[model samples]
Each structure stands twice: as structure tokens, then as C-alpha cells.
Target: MDMIAHNDSLQLYASDLYHYPSLKQPLAGLKSTKINLLFGHDEPNKKGVEDWTFSSDHRIFHEKKIPYIYFGVEDHKDYHKSTDTFQNINKSFYIDAVRLIIEAIKAYDSYLPIDSKD
Candidate 1:
């Protein structure tokens, strides 16, 4: 499950973020947060993980044992291609996703030092 904040300021975003019909969206399948931190480099974590960390910026931090949160949609038809332009982005969905990330950060901040197992 997601660990986003449940406060008043973030409450209004529930509809667009959580209630949105992601199942019907081409960029659906919000990946699990914890699983990524655990199995990021392990053969592209597919089972319960949200998405693979193929070539993400998180690799360095993960290698350093610093846990990080990833908020991203699944690959689209234009992923990593020249056609992956801003014009192709669904603005409304992008905005909602950012909002959800903000809320999640607020919630995650409460936990602070998300330490490593070692």
C-alpha cells in the first residue's frame, strides 16, 4: 500500500490521486514504494514491485543504501524515444501525480530518518 499523508491539506487530493481510475489509464500501475528500495537492482523487480528501475536516477542513492521514494507511471509507447515530448504528456494527470507526490512526501517526512537494515 501507498504511504501518502492523510492530513487535511492532502485530503482533497484523494479523489484525483487515489480515486482516479488508473486501471483505465495507459500510464497506470503505481509501483510500490518499499519494494523498489529493497529490490531495485535485482533483475528489475517485477513481481510485487510497481515498475523496474531500469535506468532511473535512484540507482546511486540505492547503491549508497539511502532509501528514496519513487513516484512514476509505467512506460508508455513513447518512452525514451524522440517522440517523448511535453506535448504528449497528459497535463491533468501530471498535475495530479505531482500533488500526490507532495502529499506522500509530507507523510514520509514524519518518519524522518528512514534508516537502513545494516
Candidate 2:
């Protein structure tokens, strides 16, 4: 109960501080789901995007041609070692990353068919 309350409080604070629009679907709904395989762009220097090392059920996904879009930055010197703060974030680069993902999703959804084999 205390954890739930804390999470709710944090969610409320995030919404208030950032004007975060409430998502209709819960996070639980996204787990184990195949997201659309939208186009991805990495910077020329390969700053934000890199090969994901975590093991995934990709072979199964690929056998069925499941699509997914991965976004976010690579682990660098500033990653989670007390140096990765809001101030260190690149604003323009972040914006471009977001825009590219948004466009990719739009284009992918428009062109691709929903996977009927579950």
C-alpha cells in the first residue's frame, strides 16, 4: 500500500511538473507486445542509438516477422553514474530523435498490417 501510494504520488508530481498527458493504456498492456517496426536513425557518430545487448525473443519474433521500434540513448560515461542529469541532456538532438521516432511510427502504421498471428 505504501509503495502504491508512493508511485501514485510520483505520477501526480510528474504530471504536474511536466504536464504529462495521461496515457489511456496502462504500462502493463505494453509488456510482451510487439511494437511496430518503424524506421530508426542513428547519428553519424552513433551517439544515442547503438546495438542493444539484452537478449530478446527476437528469433521467435523474426520467424513471425514481428515488428518493433527501439528508441533511446546509448550508455556513455555520463550514464547513471551521478553525471547523467537533466542538464547534460542534448535538447536539439533529443528533439530530433523524438521527431524521427514519431515520423517512423506514423509511416510504419500507415503502411504495415497488424499481426494476426498471436
Candidate 3:
């Protein structure tokens, strides 16, 4: 979709783009899930490495050495079929997830800008 291009446009000026929610299914009431990032040594429990590795636009940013984050979740059984609908979303989880992401971003920002993290 146009979202990828929109993100690409931010590559130059934005400090970083933390990718999230390219969800195949809406994240709703699910409570057991967590946001994942590129796994790094010594942070095994906090970071997760590689999903959408071969298939997502995030790979383009990775190749370009842009500051970005890949926060992904486990795919549900509906993965990518037409059956993925708003009706199937876990509404409460979606709200909570958004809040979690916002808070995490705030925490990350408090330390340093993304481009300077490396």
C-alpha cells in the first residue's frame, strides 16, 4: 500500500521509523503477545530477530542502513487471507498495544534519538 512509500519519504528527515502493525489481523483483545524487534546479542529476551525477512518493506530500510525498528507479532491462523476482517479483531488488545507502543516510544526517545542510538 501507499504506507510504505510514505515511510520511505521519511527516510531522509526523520530520526527513525519504528515499524509496527503491518498486521495481517487486527490486534485486539489478545493479552499474551509482545512486540518484537531485531534480536541482538546479550538482549535475547528483549529483542526478536527476523520475520517478514524476505517479504517486507522493512528489509529495504535495513539494506539502506536507515534508523528503524521492526516490531512484529505472531501471525494468527488468518495470516493473509480475505477472511481477515475488523470483525475478527481483538479490540481491547489493539487499544492496549497502541498504548504500549506509545509508551515504548517515549522511553526510547527519552534516552536518545533513533539516528544517534547506533
Candidate 4:
């Protein structure tokens, strides 16, 4: 459900480059899912993805070195604008994005170990 306002676009970025392989493996099986793996220059800077620190909740996990996936739409025309309203959202794209996230969570839950200490 990340960045629901924009559309069906999803990007996966990691704080540590080494974490991507594990994060990517499960997502790879999602048929027709167009998630992109961001790295190097494509990866988020210290302030966070798109320099919008509050854009994602995964930052805490990222700081802890826990692998995570970010499901978000790339910035759009209505971003941070007065036009950024519910009516402006692409409904079909939003639905598909949510479905994709659900599938991704199911896959990760099955493969990842639960950290009871957390």
C-alpha cells in the first residue's frame, strides 16, 4: 500500500546492497509483477528514498539491518500538490499494487524467520 496515490508502480530499495538478493528472490515468482530492484545510484540516499524521509515505514527495519521491501509508486504529477486527492488516484493501479504487496508479504512470511527478540 506504499505511495498509493501515484499508481501501480513498485520499487524495492535496500539500505544495504547485500540484502537485495534475499528480498528479491520471493518477489521474483510474482507473475507479471514489475517491481524494480534499486541499487547504487538508484538506491536511496542517507535521508531515505526520494529524499522523503516519511514516505516509507520500512526505514526502521532498514536501520536495524533487517531486510525489507518498499512498495511505492514513483513520484507523479500530483505529488505533494493540492491536486493530490483521493479522486486523483488511479483506482485500478492502486488495487493491483495492493494485491502485489499482499502476495509479497505471504511469500516473505513463509521464507523469513521470525525474530521473537524484536
lDDT of 3 at 8: 12
Estimate the TM-score for candidate 2. 0.42
lDDT for model 4 comes to: 0.58
TM-score of every candidate relative to the true structure: 0.52, 0.42, 0.51, 0.65
- How far out, in Å, is residue 103 in model 4? 0.8
lDDT of 2: 0.34
Task: Enumerate residue pairs that collide in model 2.
Answer: none
Candidate 4 segments exceeding 4 Å error: 8-19, 32-56, 114-118
**Tens-digit per-residue lDDT, 1-118, candidate 1:** 1122111122212211221233123222334232221112233434764433324665565567554544444445666677666666655455555655555556555545667875
Report the number of the highest-lDDT candidate. 4
Error of 4 at 37 (Å): 8.9
Model 4 vs truth, CA RMSD? 4.7
lDDT of 2 by residue, 6-47 (tens): 111112110110111222112212222123222223223346
Q: What lDDT does each candidate get?
A: 0.40, 0.34, 0.39, 0.58
Model 2, position 83: C-alpha lDDT score: 56
lDDT: worst 10-residue window of model 4: 37-46
| Candidates 1 and 4 compared by lDDT, better number | 4
Superposed by TM-score, candidate 4 places the C-alpha of residue 32 at a distance from the truth, in angstroms, of 4.2
Better of 1 and 2 by TM-score: 1
Q: In candidate 2, where is summed lDDT lowest over 10 consecutive residues? A: 8-17
